[model samples]
Target: MIKKYLSATLVGLSLLAASSSSSAKVIDFEDINFSPSGGFSGQDLTQRYGLNFTGGRYGFSTLTATSYSGWGAHSGNNYAWGDGYNMGIEISGNNITLNSFWVRGALMADDVGSITVRAFKGSKAVASKEFSYTETYHLETFNFAGIDRILITSRGSGPVLLDDIDVGFASPVPEPASYAMLLGGLGLLMLAARRRKSS
Candidate 1:
């Protein structure tokens, strides 16, 4: 009976872990602490949500829609304005995929120019694409996989805007240890049931 109980518990735990590991998340730039109508340095945002940033070091500003007519808030009352086109944010873990994000030009009248998004693993470049932005916000999606870093660079000298960055990973495959624990528990449970029946 104790062995059966132990086995059942192991199976439940393994299943719970598997489910939790498969979930993904999005960063709306709304939850974190930011000065109202203020800018954040690149280092300030690094690893805030499992993401690290590099290059184009000036960072972005968090401002209200009233502060800038052209910068529309993506989700909440606030949004981020890219200081320039040269910076990129990298996901901290290995084997992450570039999912999607919302971006637009930061200027009220002039075009903000084009920006390029690139995904890389170590020194190897995996995928890249360029986008042109006007005054309106646009949602961009990517299917690049095995990415460790994502770099966004502007084609022009003007500032860019970004919001709602999403990232995902492949579903977690049960590790060998997890499988072993689960199977061992199940086998013990079955054996216990059979013994109980015989008795």
Candidate 2:
């Protein structure tokens, strides 16, 4: 009975450690407070979302009924908008796998266009893809792994809208001391099992 209990405890510990290490997050841009005019710029979202936005021309805005006639937000009332051709998003602490995101062309008249997404680790570009969109929002999927930064550039006539960025954080590596503790627990379990068998 003691051996069985120890084995279960060890398994539970392993699972707990794993569960704490990795997680998936979706940035919907809804939590940001927009101005009374329904749009705002120069707000720092790093503290709230762990994403540092470079290229000073990016901001958040609402997709109202009157404005952005054909386009809509992927999830909520708000979405990220960039007037500049290029925008950069830097992950705060660790590298992440950028899974997918929702995007659309911003202009009502010139809404048909393409955008290029590039993932980088440090200064090295790892992955890149171009996606085309109409006035309606569409999901763009990617398997950009081990990337610390992502650059988005518009290839069309106008700006772009973005929302629902899905990303997975890399699992935190277990410390050496954690491995030692696990080994010690296994040793204790083996010793207990031997004693029971001999007795």
Candidate 3:
């Protein structure tokens, strides 16, 4: 009996996870503009900044930017940083979430720094993280209420492209034990139906 209940609960959880509020829907890409400055890349930071379909360094919308793969010096920390693109979004609603995702490099660096996703509440830094360095990409999610602005930045050095900047509402669902309790209550319906048939 417990096995059946657990299976049912898992199915319901998966269903909720696949729902609308659970996923970050793409609103727009705006457009990728060139930013030679404000990055850690070399060659006077001369690299295309706008999003391109063929070579996308960052993919949140239709547009994405590719970076210049070079061992560059990062600002302040002087850490080696890769050349990635910067994306800005207008935050609204009661709550907001920033899901950080990275594209793994085919040729991973020995001393790869880290990718940093910065959460900005109207130009104010709230939270940040250093993503791992490898050929496999990873995703990180954060939750906030009444957010106004957001910015994502890279921490490590070299060239890496990021895609799928998911910013949207996070859905709330009933807990598994709650689900079990609800399902247990549903058994009463079967009892009622049998009574009526016997009568």
Candidate 4:
């Protein structure tokens, strides 16, 4: 009986470690960008509120409620002013969790607009948030189970930027009891497998 139990325990530990190892890790990925083709010009004297992504291009671009003067198709199309031109990304993971990430944003007027953010896990809405324009340089954190997608939104006139996005398991991650149970289950399964093999 002791031999069976020991074999079971080891198997469980191995499985627990394997699953734990696969959790999403934090890394620097392309957060947002504002393409230069749209009057960015990359000029020194150009608009200071330029949207530069991690890759320096316009994939997953960002916009704010605050509009810029002499920008976009017309003056009204400026990045701010709640013209509704914004960008976002989709992120999710398996057996993993997500916490708050950082964002860069500011308001030209006191009437900063509203912010809308949505998160998903395999086509399911896992989380969402909307903040008033009063917040600046907001570092929003979120925790989720088996995360799989991320969504960000903004409205009105503000200049918002996002970068250095980090994703990982929750603090005090891999709860002790959860690990214990996982390891125990694996150990029992292994013992059964070995017994079947011997037979």
Candidate 5:
């Protein structure tokens, strides 16, 4: 019975260590405090979202009864507008791994024609993609590791629609003492099993 309990404890400890190492999160742009009425823009979105930004203004489709799906604004304005003529989200000091975001052409504005999305580690570009939007919005997944910033440039037009930015960060690394404890527990379990076999 003691050996069984020891083995279970070791397994639980392993799982706990793994789960405490990294976290995945999503920013759906649904936390804005706007009433969702007529056209709204010219605000610091990075500040609004508690992030960092460098570029043109960010806005949203005026609040309306009939609009994008799954939005919590006055109406259903689910899209965050970026006069993405030239824009980028800089996540310095806050080391993160950008996962993905949804992008579409800004309605009635300028179709987001072609655009280039790039992920960078400092001044070095790690990943990039040049794609054009169709009639519907698409989720562009970025699989870069330890990226500090992301930039979006309009290849053709100047406006773009964006939503649901996903990012992840590695949790603090465990201290050496944690490893010692884990190994010590396992060693005891092994010793117990060996003694049982001898008996």
Candidate 6:
């Protein structure tokens, strides 16, 4: 009976670990404050989201019916815009897996173009892919794991728009409840062993 209970406890722990590891977080850009002049730049997302933009100027804008046609926000009323040719996003606190995101070219005369996304682990490039987008938003999947930084570059004129970024931490911090459960499981195992020894 104790052997069966031990096996079941091990299985439960395995399932818990698997579930926590596979958890992903989606950043929809809806919680950010809206800019009055249509868009704003130099905003830091590190404190709230553990992401920092560098290499090029980055901004956030609220999507409008008059300015953008055919395409709309992927999740909320706002999205991130990148100026210049290249932008680098550095992930702080922990390495993350870049699951997927929505991207498209801004709705302007010269905004149609191809964009390249590259994932890096420190200084080494791990994965890269190029995607062509018009005014319509395209869902791009990377599945790049254990990456610390992501580089996005425009192959043509005009800025790139991004929304609904999905990412998962390589090492997820356990909740207090999780810790208590782990401790309880270990205590039960110890108690079972002590009882068997006494018998």
Candidate with maximal lDDT? 2
Where's the lowest-lDDT run of ten residues in candidate 1?
34-43
List the global CA lDDT of all models: 0.65, 0.68, 0.42, 0.47, 0.60, 0.67
Model 2: residue 126 alpha-carbon error in angstroms: 1.4
How big is the positional error of residue 50 in model 6, measured in Å on the Cα after superposition? Answer: 3.0
Cα lDDT tens digits for candidate 1, 1-199: 6676676777787675766464467777666544434432222444555656444445433333324445556777445555565654344555677788888766566756787888888888889998887767889998777777777777655666677778776555667787677777777877888799899
**Two-way TM-score contest, 5 vs 6, winner:** 6
Model 3 alpha-carbon drift over 4 Å, by segment: 1-23, 26-96, 106-111, 169-199
lDDT of 1: 0.65
Clashing pairs in 5: 36-63, 37-63
In model 5, the Cα lDDT at residue 196 comes to 96
lDDT of 5 by residue, 1-199 (tens): 6667677777868876886676777766555555434544333454434456565434322212224333222223444555545544344424577787777655444454776778888899988888886335788887777777777766545456666677787766778787788778777877887799899
Q: What would the per-residue lDDT of candidate 3 be over residues 51-124, giving only the tens digit for each residue?
A: 11221233322222234344221211122123443322222333466554334432345435455555556667
What's the alpha carbon RMSD for model 4? Answer: 10.8
* Model 5 worst lDDT run, 10 consecutive residues: 57-66
- Clash count list over all predictions: 1, 0, 11, 28, 2, 0
Model 5 scores what on Cα lDDT?
0.60
How far off is model 3, as Cα RMSD? Answer: 12.1
Report the C-alpha displacement of residue 77, candidate 4, in angstroms. Answer: 28
State the lDDT at 197 in candidate 3.
73
> Over 4 Å off in model 1, which ranges?
1-21, 33-43, 59-69, 89-91, 170-172
